[model samples]
Target chain A: MFPLSPILSPKGQGGGLRILTHVLALSPLAVLAWDFARGDLGANPIREVQFRTGKYTLVLLVLTLSCTPLSMLPGLKWVARFRRSLGLYAFAYAGLHFLNFIGLDYGFNLRLLREDIFEKRYAFVGLAAFLSLLPLAVTSGSGWARRLGKKREQLHRLIYLAAILTIVHFAWQDKAKTVEPLVYGGVVAGLLLVRVVGWVRRAARGTGSQTSSKEP
Target chain B: MDKIRSSEITPEHIYLGRRQFLVGAGALTASLVFLGGCRRLSELAPTPEADFCGSATAGATSDELGDPLSACDAATHYNNFYEFSLEKDDVAELARGFKTSPWTVQVGGLVNKPKTFDVDDLRRNFPPEERVYRMRCVEAWSVVVPWLGFPLAKLLKEVEPTSKAKYVRFESLHDPKQMPGQKDRSFQWPYIEGLRLDEAMHDLTLLATGMYGKPMPPQNGAPIRLVVPWKYGFKNIKSIVKIDLVEEMPTSLWTAFAPQEYGFYANVNPDVSHPRWSQSSERRLGERARRETIPFNGYAEKVARLYEGMDLRTSY
Candidate 1:
């Protein structure tokens, strides 16, 4: 019988899948850079960058959350190995989105940015969401996860809150067409509820595992 | 918030055949009043020549008070044509294949003589004039453009609206083959907008057939469109197919979709904000810096009287 290698090295050459993942993850930035150079970002380039990066971050974050459920299925435990990488990419995209706003909108004017952080409720919410993701990104290393034990899992649960806040920030900005944001919010809400339903059932069974489904 | 594009980030015309610069306004007269004394509703008159009319000539905008007009590319590309698409740039692509000819605007409902005139005949009947007006959107972005068309009041007069007609509703073409976005069913098809009777008769109100001295681009609402400069951009309904003069106030596309956000009048008021966002400030298309939006887009002197005695905060 062929042995199942559960812990796939997301960055290692041991599996060709890691190379594919790396290429796929970083290709969006390359395409964006090409588009920017080609002047294909349309009339409002800054907005295009900000919107695309934000959307990419949301998509990757959703993907990271989906990994746990997929890994729980038999013979698919290897999907969990990509969660940290997906999360790290989501954080990277989020950083790009925020930086686009700061550099383009405020031109690094700290006073203006501070005023915005106070005046713009969406900006405040965005800052909170980013700050929440910062620690998760920093401690994404497997060694740190091992040291903190279960506390690390609790800290990462803040991601769901961050996702909701991010959608709120997005929805608030969309004044004209709201259905798009509402659709995104609904998707995230459904993902969170799915996780909670499983969590509750486990708690009811007296095996209340706080960590992810494939915690090992 | 305003955005500054880096020197490296220049705009390239993604769509082919997009006009870059505005053509000079040669044959346009910015006459303020189309109808003067001794004028009946059915009476039609050719455009009064400046040399012949002498003192009776309607005063036109001779001097400009504000900045230069927005570039043709920016005005054409950055549009909010929901029928074609939602995103500004996508509309330019989606509407490129649209056919704009053989168009007729049907003027009916509570009118003395209901008529359907081809868009060409309408343009010829009322001599096209030039109007450089600042268009402010509810989204807080603005643009100043040279729109070429005649007063909308002229067309409303030709139809001879009955006294019972208190409102004028404008409807856009709803074919999905021409406008791909209609397939989504997100918004009610056949986008409709309306203006009060007096507001429709205002000289500033125009049946814009063209912009930048050229025929209106399909993406920017070709054939025929309305332009109420003092109101929000959405009030300037595009690709209009029907003009109905109704007794009661008619519901519009934006207001019907979201009543709290889009009011019926939609007159530009810096004091009255959209529920979700502030209308106090606007970012000009070319200039990225945010500027304080003026009351009625700085034409309060002409339009403020229309909203007299009404609470702007509540009405909005």
Candidate 2:
């Protein structure tokens, strides 16, 4: 049982929800900026920023994935409409996380960055995840999706791979405290399982109907 | 990596009292704002002499090193005392009210003169001396701390290790009730660490009692801890209660947990990378730029000779 608030309803004002989404998405960045200015980012500010941005990126991606499952409920198809915006926000945070690593931490030191990419498992997987999100973000517009047709769906399915890589990146980066990353991995696995189960049920039903028609 | 902030000393007890008062009032939200303001204000305010140790000498050795000492707030609050908590930032809060008094360190095993000295007696006898050193964490972060203590060599000499002793094993106090982190069975309790007898006798290896010219905070290994400047931070075991001079190499908590990742000799070597991450460079506390990690953490001239002819790559 879920709350039937206006935001969850099909008849809700799209403009209000869009504004709420943007405000919610931008608030973390604003808080980080404020903390940076006030010198409240603790001992290692660059690290604090990297951790926050990376965490939010995974969180937003999880929310974006959940939209598909939520939309299957009666009168909750409106949730699907927010998927693009949520996904783009996740992509934006991922970009910030990458920038923090390169610009702030590395000071655009190309050699060091290159070495990390090659030598470190976490760095390689993180870069791969971000690269996978890049194409999805670029072609997120409705125009490109329409032009590409079913191919667009196939391309966007890379989110699953991106999600898995992102979790691995996070889990590996932590020296200790595995629980937080493990929780994220579990959620992603559960969301993907829902989609797989739904697809399997539909395929079974379709085959059953085809066999029945052939018999008639 | 050493710099003295003699003028910047803020006693831990006074600060803890202030924090407790704010918490008592249930003004945690207001306290956050207060702390933010105090960060700027504390710098301008001159602090009084610490009451912990009378005639506590200032940092003469570290003043010439030139590397700015990390903020006392950061050095104390950000700790890897897994006995308290796994989270570095959370250790301070979690270790509050941890009893460090009435502490006795048992020095025995292969020592000719096995002795169990009360911590206070040891402190008084050795006298707190300031030795600021660069502490490089295995996680690739570092801090320069003005630790107040005498060398481990002095203590070991007093006990007089026998010819049979090859390695020195150190153990921390293990009370699961006081240290809630010990309740988690995933981690080994009563944190254990070891050093080769020679390494333990190195002049830089300190039996630290305090830092920033005050008594050590409970979070930062109150009463006493180890400070091995050349080795990674984990090797510098905290809140130590037992020191046994043994023949065999002791299995340290980290080494036992992941032997491949954390080797017995966790010396700071730029060439030797951790299994998961590079140790080539490290981010110093409060600085954005990364500094190249040198062999033996820049104490190579003094310590490189200790590891002569040994292949660092394989050993690491």
Candidate 3:
């Protein structure tokens, strides 16, 4: 039901829908902060914070992946402008989740922190997913676009890798409940399938064509 | 048809009975039922069915230390009962239709006297008492529950364990019509759990029939379930229908489902982190601060000796 044209107008990239997406993207944290302020994070606030932030990161990662496919849809090209906000919010949440685990949970016990990051497969993968997103998040700007030119597109493609790692991280982390993770995995798989199918179509068209459409 | 009422608090005993445990402590449980009798069992708020014994004289503890009780609402709402659904809230909603009556447990395998005991038989044989215990999950969340049941050791002793019985395997009820999540094959049907013979014999391991004093809601594994405090919550297999004493160490639902991730003895050793996450600390349910996880969930003095020579990191 959201009207996308006004927010993603040609000249005004940061329009109504962009602002709305930013608000929606970051609202879970606001609710969480409210939960913290109200002492409503159940028994363990640290775990709650870690869990919510991680979930938001994963969800935003998935949502970010969906933005490109949405752009490909007829009349929905404007949705691409919303992707950068999603990506940044995803990174911010991932940072919060990481900081919560290391700072509050482990209290920066480097040995133990090292053990979680370097040793635990789930932790390692989660950290890897966040690390993969770091460069993409940093370069998600018009300035980076002006400076890097064609290189910006290549660097931003790491978002796809980040998406895959994030799904893997979620799937591996959950113990008994595979339904939610599998659903998320299915969504990521579907998104990747879209990309793969498009790549195959482009390859079939011919290699000599220099106007190969860059994926958003 | 075979449902044990609150009045039938069985006194038959081989070891210390509920009376010996409770009455010996001198004082009775006080009449302080939280928030009043107006509590209603709705989807919004958990009305903890009053503890069967309002004033259980014997105080339950992890070791010598007492576990602060978890809010009943949070415990019932935040269950990992994948048999019904993966979503925590859906557990109660989806499980509302489950029929927990007419349940019978087959005490079989290497036991001296293998017999099928109905729910009533179990209640008639072993009196349930309130035990406030630290219930930890592999997901790194925890709760201190006031469980109503007797030691599993007592039941194993009742049938008289054969010398060959080195392990005790507990199996959950398998009714697809009732448990919808079983339809997905996410976990093997009729969830199974196990303990070393010594672990089963330990007084702390209980066969929980109820929580917060009233009969356990179906969402929390109604009829009956195992409550191994030191072990992860999955080890406390819900709606158990079989207690199989076996010669070999049995493969529990989790261990068989994913041997790489879950171990037979899912002890609470923060040092031995899960492959996916840090187990160094856990968030107690209904509270905010992440607390350091205790070895064997603070029951190391009682159970650590069982694994004196075994390497926990590998086995776990």
What is the full ranking by TM-score, best candidate first? 2, 1, 3
Residue B73's C-alpha lDDT in candidate 3? 66
lDDT of 1 by residue, A1-216 (tens): 012212454333224444445556676777678677866665666777887788777767776777777667665566676678888988999999999878775467675567567666877898898999999998889899899877898799888988888888888777555586787788788878877887777776655554444343
What does each candidate score in C-alpha RMSD? 16.7, 14.3, 18.3
Off by over 4 Å in 1: A1-16, A106-128, A142-147, A168-194, A201-216, B1-63, B275-278
Tens-digit lDDT string for candidate 2 (A95-118): 999999999998888887888887
**lDDT of all predictions, in order shown?**
0.75, 0.81, 0.75
Residue B278 lDDT, candidate 2, scale 0-100: 59
TM-score of chain A of 2: 0.88
Model 3 docking category: incorrect
Superposed by TM-score, candidate 2 places the C-alpha of residue A165 at a distance from the truth, in angstroms, of 0.7
For every prediction, compared with the true complex, DockQ reads 0.07, 0.20, 0.14
Q: Write the per-residue lDDT of candidate 1 for residues B65-171, one digit (tens) a residue.
A: 64677766678778899887678866765677578889988999999999999999988888888888889998778888888899999998889999899998889
Q: Write the per-residue lDDT of candidate 3 for residues B1-316, one digit (tens) a residue.
A: 9889856855545222442333222111211111111112222353333232343333443424655676676777677888888666457667875787888889989877888889877888888888888888887788888888999888888789888888988888787888888898767777888889999999998998887767878888898998989898889989888888898888877777888778888888887867775688777776545677888998888888899889898888
CA shift at B27, candidate 2, in angstroms? 28
Highest-scoring model, DockQ: 2
Q: Tell me the spans in candidate 3 whose CA falls farther than 4 Å from its real position.
A: A1-14, A27-52, A66-77, A103-111, A177-216, B1-63
